[model samples]
Target: MYRYDEFDRDFVSARVAQFRDQVERRLSGDISEDAFKPLRLMNGVYLQLHAYMLRVAIPYGTLSSKQMRMLAHIARKYDRGYGHFTTRQNIQYNWPKLGDIPDILEDLAGVEMHAIQTSGNCIRNVTADHFAGAAADEVADPRPYAEILRQWSSLHPEFSFLPRKFKIAVTAAENDRAAIQVHDIGLQLKKNDEGQIGFAVWIGGGQGRTPMIAKKIKDFLPEADLLSYVTAIMRVYNLHGRRDNKYKARIKILVHETGTEELAAQIEAEWAHLRDGELRLPDADVARITDYFAAPDLPARAEGWAELAAWKKADSGFASWVTQNVRPHRHPDYGMVTISLKPIGGIPGDASDAQMDAVADLAEQYSADEIRVTHEQNLVLPHVALADLEPLYRALQAEGLATANSGLVTDIIACPGLDYCALANARSIPVAQEISERFGDQARQEEIGDLKIKISGCINACGHHHVGHIGILGVEKKGAELYQITLGGSADENTSIGEIVGRGFEPEKVTDAIETIVSTYLSGRSGTDEAFIDYYRRVGAAPFKEALYGDKAEAA
Candidate 1:
């Protein structure tokens, strides 16, 4: 929702021109693939298994209705008629031509969006709670701080080529919807007893071969010190982080080797010099950014379709949808609606051009022209009037976008694995598709109760499989696709890494393996209301392992 100032616009335009020249150089043979690799990556272009993929950063997952429409246009005109929304709350065009990326970047800059930090080992896009401005219980909106971070990190000279990719997530909700615990740096907005706002800082959290929750570096950071404190933390990590192996280069590894106490001490020492310096945010600067996210005013009473209330009472289907899709807003008369990208039999995060346009139109017409992309791979209309629910629901349903399965079993989060990513050992989309199809029935999915299924291509954990309630990681054994399942993982305030159940199952056996795991939970659980996590925490993975591999088999 933030518009680009003159400095911002010029910065992006210059970067685009720079990339255009680099591209021309590469095509003219002045630069080979090896030479152009880093340059292209810096611009968020990747040479995937098939074609070049362009990742456009949606800063802190905020987009205006105009920006949303521009993305839809890009999907239709430039590449395929669809785009993939990622777990990072960014959008990916799977088939962008190598030569057309500059044009794409130009179009993106026109809408005040850029792809600068969407890739590479440098600091990536800073993610925040998707429900930031709209959440009723938020301490303060996190986008202003996130925007400050974006400006400071963009093309930063010293940290540009860091040891590994860095991620930061900020959340103010009582429940950590942003999964802040699993980020390189996590900021939770908190208010002390004195009623002054500040941050609770956590550092060194990430998922991969080594999954670790972030440890708290500081319990309370003054609001004015947010940017400077973040600088100190990044500086410490940038200096001490390991670079010996790509797999172990993250700040988490440094936290492990140096011990959290020592790491915190180093950050504190660095902060003593930087705090209250030029980087410290002033109230005027904070107010200028906050003005962009001002809450939309709504009618005192939105005129309802009496038909909708009747439908809610009479039809359980509609009721279930309202229960899952609708989220509370800070405004009394307004609410936020999550439009599920994962409909039955559809890919988890892929959205057709028409669907995007329809959602964009709805955001402009029914909502206040505000849209948000959640890390769960869903689109949110943040200011829909409570009274207009029926018409919005109908419009979404007609476009096949109204699947009320948020946070349910079929609501899967997955990465574009072997299908798109060259680093993937096995295909993740098909596995996600199969699981979604297997639990396609609405009644069955609801009866299964609250469950999360995430699939990652490899140990890098791009799909966030490590934090899923029923996490599935795709691997390759003898060039054959196999899946390894993990249970008891979650990504919220109570974050924990899942434990592996047993040996890997062949591709054909994976869906069945998941079914067995779910079935075992249903039978052993106290009731259908108990979530898969509750069952896992109650009885542990022993019984589930037996169900997947059967009684006489050994649990891996």
Candidate 2:
């Protein structure tokens, strides 16, 4: 919730004016399609298969109720009646007219938001843990550092046009909810032995055609040296990262080609020259940023504990919702409520304008007037009082937002595959919808336990299929859609890339294949206590492969 200053307002206003002129030129035929490509991309506009797509940045995934209202307004006025929330915690409007983009940008600027760096080969939106300020186990809120990075990297001349797009994620919790290990640069905030906060820096982690977990380049870097160290890493990558081939242009590729030791040495050498320089952050500056993210005051609500127990006893539906969508907060009297966008058989991450508006109203009335967009494509009210749970649940239910499936099989994550994305090889939404309907039963989902099923239309890994417990990739073969399955992949603290189980399945067979995998896991697991990921790791891919492909598992 960092408020924009005069400088920010002026900068955004100026950019809007510039883009407005560019858009006008394109519409008037002064600029051709090829000429307008990079300009449009820089402003977060994409010419998709059907129409123009506009991606708006929600930095660190924090939004005020007022801003949420504006998002709903955009959906209602500019494009379709709904928008897609992405894995990066941003939102996409799939069918906006080309001429109206500048107006959309202006509208966003009014709320201190923009689409800059949401696309292009630059440092994209700096993301952090959605529950940063509210998590019980956080050493410090990572959003302050993320904001600092945003201020530093916006329109940075040196790193603006890198070899390929760059992403950075930060997290202060041990649970790794932000999937930091899969980012180009990942920062884990931790306290040292002396009780000083710093970061464990990881670089070269990404998930495209070549998925690699980041390597820890520094065990613990002083908080003051964050910018200097990060700049050093950027400098190294900018100088030596692949440029001739877009396929291998990411920093992860460079890390693979150049040994970690040598790369770390080079970064350290570069840091030695810049560590004590102007880039070093002062304590006063850090304090100023941290003040902007101070936790909201919460009066005691001890009576809610007793009241909540009574309510749960009275209503099983309410009880189920509480059990699934509610997470423990730093405050004992408070809870984090996840509003699942993936309703059974509905499109994952697509929220109608009315639903968005309803969430905004609920956040204003029950929560602390703040909303968080999770990397899992869900909205979170991070500081809801336990006493307010029932009313909030009822309001969300009325809007069809209270689908008690936070981490279940029905809470699937998918990209805007062939339906919207031109780069996609096949459709992703129908597959997600099919799988969601198959496991829509609450009892059956509970039986399966916590599972993540991520699907991507292509190898771009937009849906983060590489890290799901049951990852599905849709590929085109012989001019037909084929879905590939990968098992045991996870995006938690112990991150691991999923392995392909066998040959790709036809679109019609993909759901059945997923059902078979789940059945195999249920039968093979030692007990219900053993999660799908744990069981898969324990036994490896042999059993699931055998179950999916039968005697031909070895060949598969």
Candidate 3:
């Protein structure tokens, strides 16, 4: 993780002091709610149904042990006993008193963290692959680039207060774990013909009332011009992005209206002015940032196949965990373990203070003193030895962080629906819990194979429902909470938005409808060789739609 510098330190302290005064003003009645709204949002404080919620930025979802322990302290001292890790890979405290927010900010600053750009219509936290540095197939570490982007966008005078919230994601791996295609700006790091590292840049992608896969603006931007390239893209959007209507304010809308070719042309023109300007990255700067991300020291090769396979066979529970929870690390004998937050019916991304503390401890003891948060809202010990699996699992199980359902159907991704955000039509977490209970059996979940079931409370697509193999969006029909199901959607190298099956289902009917769809896939799919997404793409949504609604149940 990049340590905060003096300038960064001072900026946060000043911002904290500023926000403290604003909170005082809001509380003391010097300003009306409307007057204080933007100020609070900029600080990541949301006035929710029952209390104020504060979301703290964990840039690129990287954390030092000291930082994780600090978050645990904050959770224990302030709000509820827990914090919710989000799909965006940030953490949120559900209830923080208005007055205590300043103190909380100060506490976060103590560990070199803050809530700046966590919210508001500015560029938000830049999420990257959880297994970033450690992923075996990665061409390069993406976080240094993500950090560069953070510096470039943070309080940036030009791009701040854009059409709507801007999100950018980067991934070095070809697997697309970061869902880069669904972000406002998605950069996939790649090696060009000359073998110099650059980016396959995609812009204007987003998931909201309108979902769009980012169109490629540049096939290969040179390594030196990364910042300038990004600036050019943002500049183009800021100048022409819709601000006349909130619904159509995102860069996605602009991409739709202007067409990608014209948008690319505009970005190129903008790049002409800035590509090699002062904002252009020098090799030395890249080297400096890259220095922060040097790989953890790994021991010489030792293949422990018998020991690992024994652990796998002796403990099928741990085997299931290894199957889903563990991912290959670049180091031959090391692996990354995902601590699933979706434990049965609980909130998807939430972790108690004690759990956070334990995770930090485990990271320090069994692995390097580093932790990572995933876009799927899970935690990762990025460099755990294969030999350390049993002990780590035991420790994680002790902390209630061992769920073992990393990418299964029940491991659903849900937004902070109507319960927290006033914008949502229905509550997404409860819906996720209900679905989890509906398919609670371990055997049943294993039977279903790898499936991504995501839910967003509203059309804003906060939960990324549009990309789930089986996507569920909770909507308002007259006054009731109903669900619209979309099938065959994906956010991978070949990204595509889901197709809606038919009429929406009431909350009660949703679980069964999903079961029906899954059952249809199981029965009709070409053997167990087919994943849900592969089957959907091969046969299309018509078969699933017929199963979900039947012939008579088809239309709205």
Candidate 4:
């Protein structure tokens, strides 16, 4: 993880004090609600349904043990005893009092963390692949570039106060675990024929009332030209992006209204101005940031196949957890262990304070003192020794974090819907909970294979429901909570937005509809090896629709 320099430290300290003053003024009635809205939003504080919610940025979703412990401390002291990890790989405190926000921000700054840019229409948190440095197929670590962007966009006077929120994501892996295709600006780190590094830039990708996959603007931008290129894109959006309507204010809308070619041309024209200016990233600076993310000093050891095999034979439960929750690492002797927040019938991505502390302890002892938050709403011990699997599982089980359903049907992603957010139309957590309980059995989940079910209360797409294999969006229709289902959506390398199957189902009938869809897939699939996504792509949504709405409705 990149440690904060003197400038970074001083920057956060000043911002905290400023926000503290702002909060005090609002509480003292010196500023009205409308007057304090932007001020509080700039600092990542939101007035939710029942209380104020604070979103703390976990930049690139990387955390040290100390930072994790501080989050646990905040969860224990300020709000409730738990925090909700979000699809953006950030954490949210849902019950923080308005007066306590400044203190919470101060505590976060103490651990080199903050809530800045986590909200508002400005550039939000810069995210990256969860297994960035440790992934077996990574071309290079993307965090250095992400950190560079973070520094550049932090409070850039030019780009702040855009028409709507901006999100940027980077990934070096071919798998696209970071969902680059669905971001405002998506950069894929790649090496060209000459083995020089750069990025394949994509723009206009987003999901809301209108969903879109980003269009490729640049095939290969040079390494030194990254900052200038991104600046060009931003300049184009800031100048021409929609400002009259909040609904169409996103850069994605601008790209949609004006074609990609024209957008790219405008961006290029803008880049011609700033290409070699002060915005050009220097080689020495890039190298300095890159050095901060060098791989830890890990010793080489033979694969622990014999011991792991023996343990698996002895304990079936451990074996199940290992099979589902473990990912291959760059180093053969090590593995990336995913601590699933989706226990059977539990809320997705909700980690208690005690669980956070326990994960920090486990990371320090078993992993290399590093933790990662995934876009799928799970935590990762990015570099755990294969030999430590049994003990790690035991510790995680003790903390109520040992769910063996990392990518299965039960591993759901849900947003804080009507339960917390005032913008929500219906409840999302209970829907997720019901579906989770429906497929809670390990054997049934294993039978379902790698299926992602995402739920959002409304069309803001905070839950990333647009990209799930089975996307559920809860809507209010005729004074009832109805769930709309979309099939074949995925956020992987071959990203696609799901298609709506039919009429929305009532809340009580949602679980049965999901089961019907799953049953249809199981019956139509070529084999178990064919994942839900691949099968859906092959067979189309016909059978699933028929299963859900019957033959005449499917034909219609």
Candidate 5:
């Protein structure tokens, strides 16, 4: 919810003008593609398989109704009729014309949104928990710190072009919904016994060909030293991180090679020089940013729970949808509403222009004119009153946004794979659609429980396949597409990378394989009380592996 000031507006406007000129130069043949590639990438433009893709950042996943409406406008006027919400809490226009991207950037700028740092080897968007301000269990709002970090890192002279792309996530909730453990720098906002807010810092966590859970570089980092500490860490990584090989250039790889102890020492040594310097955040600046994210006013008791309960009792579908999509908010009379982008047999996170418009309207009417884009590839109306739940649900249902599958099996997270991404090996969206359709039954999905299935086209792990309870990685084998399945991966506070269960399956067999795994889990689970993740942890991957390979092994 942070608004742009004069300086911020001028910065973005200048960058837009610069990029506009660069684009024109490229189009006019004044510069070749090789010369224009970095410039376009710096502006969040990418030449995809068929056309160009434009990624727009939703900082800390916060947006206003005005911003959402602007995004819908871009989807309608510029690119295809729909846009894809990515795992990073960003939106991607998969079919934008190279010539029209400047216009798109200008449109975004009008709404205080931009494409800068959404791509290329720099500190990308600073993400936080979607439930940051509204979650009942949050320690504090993490957005203020995230915004501070965003401002500090944005176009920083020293760290502008790192060896590889970097990501940072902050979460104040006891539950790590932000998946901080798997980011380049994961900050878990915490309070000490003295009630002072600080962060438990984790470094080097990432998922790609080489997946890692970040190490705790600092058990507790004071709030005041945030920028300084982050700077120190970046300096260490920038200097020591590999540039010779793109594959091993990430901070995760550097951490692995240098060892956590040496890395921590280096960071600490660097911090000694930078601590209490110009980067040390002042209390006044922090307060100003915090004021921008102040919680909305809500009545202590809104008269709607009784009627809502009655409605739920009368309508099973409504009850189911509420149970799945409605999350507990800090305010008792309000609920956080998750708008599912994953409709059955459709792309996982694609929202049409009309859907976007409807969601924007709903956010303005029911919520406090604010919206949140979740890392799970969903949109959230974070502060809806209980009285407004029925109307909001009705509105969302009419818009095709009410899928009633948040955290369910059908609520899949998949990247734009072979269909759009040039780096992809196989089609991910189709696989996600097939899986969603396979488990599309409401009864079956509920029976399956809170199962997370993440699909990535390649090892880059854009879909967060490494942390999914059931992770699917599509790979190219010979001339055919093979899907590899990993079990027991989780992205929560207790983060763990999944293990491959067996040999890869052909694309056609993937759904069946997933079904077999689920079936095996249901049969072998301690009881219905035991969740898939708990059961998988207790029983290990043996049962699932046996279920998958039993017949094949015998035949061999």
Candidate 6:
């Protein structure tokens, strides 16, 4: 929760005024659609298939209860009654009128949020581990560095309008919850042998038509040299990255074409000139930013441990929810509660305005008045005391937010496919809904174990299907929708791109195909202890392919 200063407020207010003028011009016919296209995009507005879509940035996925309330207000007052939480931890409103967007932007600016850099080829919102400040195993909170990057890159003259969109992710936890490997630039904060903090820099990782894991360009970049090093990488890419084709414009493509060694050398050469210059972060500034993210004070709640055990014994439903949605926190007396937006058979990440309001109330009452949006399309109360669990669960249940399917098959991640996105080939929501309903049973989900099923309407990988344990990609073929399946992909520390199992299945057959894959995994796994990903890695995609396509698997 970095509070905006006077300068920050003035900056955002000025941008809002500028966009308001632009929007007015477009509406007044002073500017044609062609002329206003780039202007609208820069302000985070997209002309979708049916209506305009507005993407609001939730930087590093942190939100105050007040901010959450503002989001809920926007949803209730402006567009449809709900908002879609995206894989990037942002939110999208699908049915906003073009004229009302500036008013919406003004509302967002009032809460220190905006739509800037949420789209376009500039560095998008700098994301970090949703569990950054609360994770038990974090070396340091990554949000401060993320905020620093945000401040530096916002409207940066040099890096703006790059060959393609750029994304950067940072994580301090060893578990890699941020999916840093699949970002244009990934930073893993770690302590050196001498106990000095730094980052393990990875560049060129991305997913689209060409999915590639980022390569480690620097083993250790001093925390102070973060900006300098990152700028060097950007300079290299900006100079050489392809501009002719949007298909091959990402830095990942440049990394593939230019050898990693040569690229590293170029970055180093650039860094030598800038490392000790004005870009170097001073310890005082770093400390000031870090202070903004200091952990909340947690009074001892030791009695909750006993109370929680008794509550679990009394209610199986509550017990199941605790087992699924809760994660260990840095404080033993507290837990990180993931409020699953993906209810069984419900749209994966769509939250109604009332639900958002309810979550805000619960966060203020039970948690520390803070909410986190996960890349998995879930909301998190990161500092809920164990004692507050029962009431929080009950409140969330009433709001229909307590699904108890955090990492299960029912906790699906999908994009706004053909239903909303003009670039989409087929509908993603229907497929996600069908799969969720198929495995809606709690017992069945438990049997399936931890599984991630990501679906994208097209090859853009908006749903991160490339890294899903069971990925579903929708493609158009011969005037029909075909769903392609990829198995064994993961977005964790040991990141790997999934392999296509076989020929694409018809929309009607996709659910059945997914069921077959799950059944095959259950039967082939050595024991329940072996997760789907582990088993798939152990045996490769051959078994799933065979099960899906039968004897024709080889040809596929």
Tell me the alpha-carbon RMSD of every candidate: 1.3, 0.6, 1.2, 1.0, 1.1, 0.7
Model 5, span 224-246: residue lDDT tens: 99999999999999999999999
lDDT of each: 0.90, 0.95, 0.89, 0.93, 0.93, 0.94
**Per-residue lDDT of model 6, residues 469-523, tens digit only:** 9999999999999999999899999999999988999999999999999999999
Candidate 6, residue 487: lDDT? 91
Q: Which of 4 and 6 is ahead in lDDT?
A: 6
**Candidate 2 overall lDDT versus native:** 0.95
Q: Mind giving the per-residue lDDT tens digits that candidate 3 earns over 176-209?
A: 8888889889999999878999999988788888
TM-score of each: 0.98, 0.99, 0.98, 0.99, 0.99, 0.99
Stretches of candidate 5 above 4 Å error?
551-556
Which residue runs of candidate 3 sit more than 4 Å off their true CA positions? 301-304, 553-556
Predicted candidate 6, C-alpha RMSD: 0.7
**Model 3, residue 495: C-alpha shift (Å):** 1.2
- Residue 473 of candidate 5: its Cα lDDT? 98
**Of 1 and 2, which scores higher on lDDT?**
2
Task: Give candidate 6's whole-model lDDT.
Answer: 0.94
Candidate no. 4 TM-score: 0.99
Q: Candidate 2 on 463-514: residue-level lDDT in tens? A: 9999999999999999999999999899989999999998999999999999
* Model 6 TM: 0.99
Q: Which has the higher TM-score value, candidate number 2 or candidate number 4?
A: 2
Ranking by lDDT: 2, 6, 4, 5, 1, 3
Worst-scoring 10-residue span by lDDT in model 4: 547-556
